[model samples]
Target: MADDLGDEWWESQPAAAGSPGVLAANANSSDALCGPSKTWIWTELNQRASSLQKPSGDEEGRDTEMMQQDTAPVPEPSQETKQPMECFLTQAKETKEETRKTKKWKKKKISEILAKSEPKPGTPGDLQQLIKDHYSGSRSVIELEELNLPDSCFLKANDLTHSLSSYLKEICPKWVKLRKTHSEKKSVLMLIMCSSAVRALELIRSLTAFKGDAKVMKLFAKHIKVREQVKFLENRVIHLGVGTPGRIKELVKQDGLNLNPLKFLVFDWNWRDQKLRRMMDIPEIRKEVFELLDMGVFSLCKSESLKLGLF
Candidate 1:
């Protein structure tokens, strides 16, 4: 019964109905037992309160510093480093275009040069030189002798000798007259004309009724005579008709007028047998001779029949 009364008295004490002094007395009692509990409480409370509340000024300062670091400007590439690449690309394009233009210009220049350099044919100077160089040669004079008869003489005998002789007399009068004029002064011209006349005589000898009238022969001989003192110009005579070979042979036989002596005399000094044969063998020589003969510029006959054979 006493213990119960004591317990009741402790529970019902006035301290329990706390006052400021009473709370202070309890804090003092706890502090005395724990020894500086305020510091530990303050630390723990600060940490927990900070986690729960909005950030303080110190924390905000740290965050702002980190954001400033992130936003800071990085160094840009230098102008010098970038310029070369742009310059190189620009130069490459320019160089390629320039090369293309250069090639086009070169081609144009080459074409222009070729056009300007092309040769003109049939110039007057060229024709004159051709005549002087080729027609003035002894070979040309010899080639003139190959047109003794027309190729189709039998069918057109009248036309053949008549047309041929007339053409020869007209075209070659200069050479023929030169032969007569310069027989002593120019042996070469004399020989060439004499040879030509001999070939002409051979053609005349082969004609039918063309007995080569004495008067006509005399005029022909006078025109060709090499003497300087004789004035031997006569009216032009024309031998127009054709005669048979039998009649021609009879006239030649009756008169015993051998033309071989004149032929041999003309050909003897100018031509050697081997050289003549070689010249005759050349296809170009033969063709040129035949063409000249066809044009009635000359005449050719068998040198053998004219007693020009080396044997």
Candidate 2:
């Protein structure tokens, strides 16, 4: 009966909400045995604490699944999330291409403007500039009034009459008689400097206006070698030498074209080449011209025998 009462007392006691796994005792342990009863109650409390400390099987499985979910790897970004960045990169590339195109168009526009602003040859202003550029390397460009050149040597007013026949009549009216004498001496009496073979041929054809003109010889480096022409001039009585400065120099070096009776130095001065450059404006042609001047051609000018005429 006492044990039963003690048991009933323990069962009737309520646990406090504030403290879990805690035990409380009533003051009614006076009827119970001290040692064993206290031991039994403490043993019961320890068993309850142990039972509460361990979880049920279902609870353990749920906790394990939650931990696995937390530790799982984070997945890579989806295509949807990356779309904005890819679109940004594509737009940046297109913008750069447009910028490059704009710069190229600007460069082309600037080049066209420069080409239009630059001067072309044949105008009066361009002719003045051409003359200036031609004699830029010369020591002096003043008119040679001290020379007192003969009227028959050069055309008056520094004009070639704008045509070959007119030019012939103006400066070389007695060319037929003069060439006859030069033919007997087997010497070149005149050197007509042209820009190219085409111009040289044109002038040669124009001399046929009289239908019985003197013999003419081509001294250019087209369809023939310079050395071969030098060999031919030795046997031929060439009265007029027509060619570019380059081929004429080869003849002078080989002592083929005799300059003894040579008195007139005619230049195709008004003609501009493809690049709008005159004969003296070109470096190689100008250098060859200076070389020809050094080869006893200018000695005639010093002796008042040679005269310059623009044709």
Candidate 3:
């Protein structure tokens, strides 16, 4: 019985070869044997991946563009945005105008001060007032009393309305006669005391209009030596002498200047310098002027020989 079964099984195996199972197995083996190459498979995979990535990258770019649009800046709503710039401009203009006004005010103030400082024309009482005002603190009561001068002590100043030349002409009407008779050397017929050498020179120049070819000596201490001045005086007859009080006092002390022939003792009293200071305003000059007066000028005035003139 076993031999017969073995023959039957062998026969069944041959029939199964043509069945669906055997055919499906042969198809799978064939597919495995004829599969695509490695490079073709890689190329296919890469192409699919690139196609999918391209859509995703495009979508991402569109999303970023939409976000940028949403966050974009907008224009201002009104002209009110320019208010700060306009305000700054307005403030600058106001500051400029204020500065201009300040400068103008300063100029006006300076003009007023200068006008106040300028000296006015003097009167007969001007001399007395000035002497009192200037010497009240310095001189004693006795000295102040001594320093007093009557109306006769001062020359006729009503005609002295203008320049030094005009004043000289008004006061010294007989200057020519006096100059002719003034033959003494180292002596001057008229002595004009000033504050500085420059003033002395100025007075001398002003005298050209009044004094016609008559000898006028400069008696200031600037440049010229005392001995030279004394020698000049001794050699020439000077009709008019214009000098500072200090130098005049010095010369008088040295006997280089003679006051015997002096008729007009004129003081440049009313004149003011750039500082608005008069001759008596300066302490040293005032002292010298007083000393010069004390050195026989006051005595001569008391005797009515030498008249005091304030020009």
- Which candidate has the top score in TM-score? 3
User: What's the C-alpha lDDT at position 36 in model 1?
Assistant: 66
The lDDT of each candidate is 0.35, 0.67, 0.79
Per-candidate clashes come to: 6, 0, 0
* Whole-model alpha-carbon lDDT for candidate 1: 0.35
Give the lowest summed-lDDT range of ten residues in model 3. 10-19
Error of 3 at 206 (Å): 1.7
Query: Which regions of candidate 3 are displaced past 4 Å?
Result: 1-114, 130-143, 158-160
- Tens digit of per-residue lDDT, candidate 2, span 1-311: 75867667756666742235244342344355477777776677667766677888999999999999999999987776557888999999999999999888874443465478853323333333443555466635463222223444334333423575676556667877776666544367677787789878987887676325566789798898977887777777777777899988888787777676786777766666666666766778777876786687555666767766665
TM-score of each: 0.23, 0.52, 0.59
Model 1: how far residue 225 lies from native, Å:
38
Summarize candidate 3's per-residue lDDT along 17-69 as a digit string, tens digits: 33455445545455554446644644554565466546677788999999999
TM-score: the better of candidates 2 and 3: 3
Off by over 4 Å in 1: 1-65, 68-71, 81-120, 125-173, 183-311
Q: Point to the candidate with the largest lDDT.
A: 3
Model 1 — which ten-residue stretch has the worst lDDT? 185-194
Winner on TM-score between 1 and 3 is: 3
- Candidate that beats the other on TM-score, 1 or 2, i.e. the better one: 2
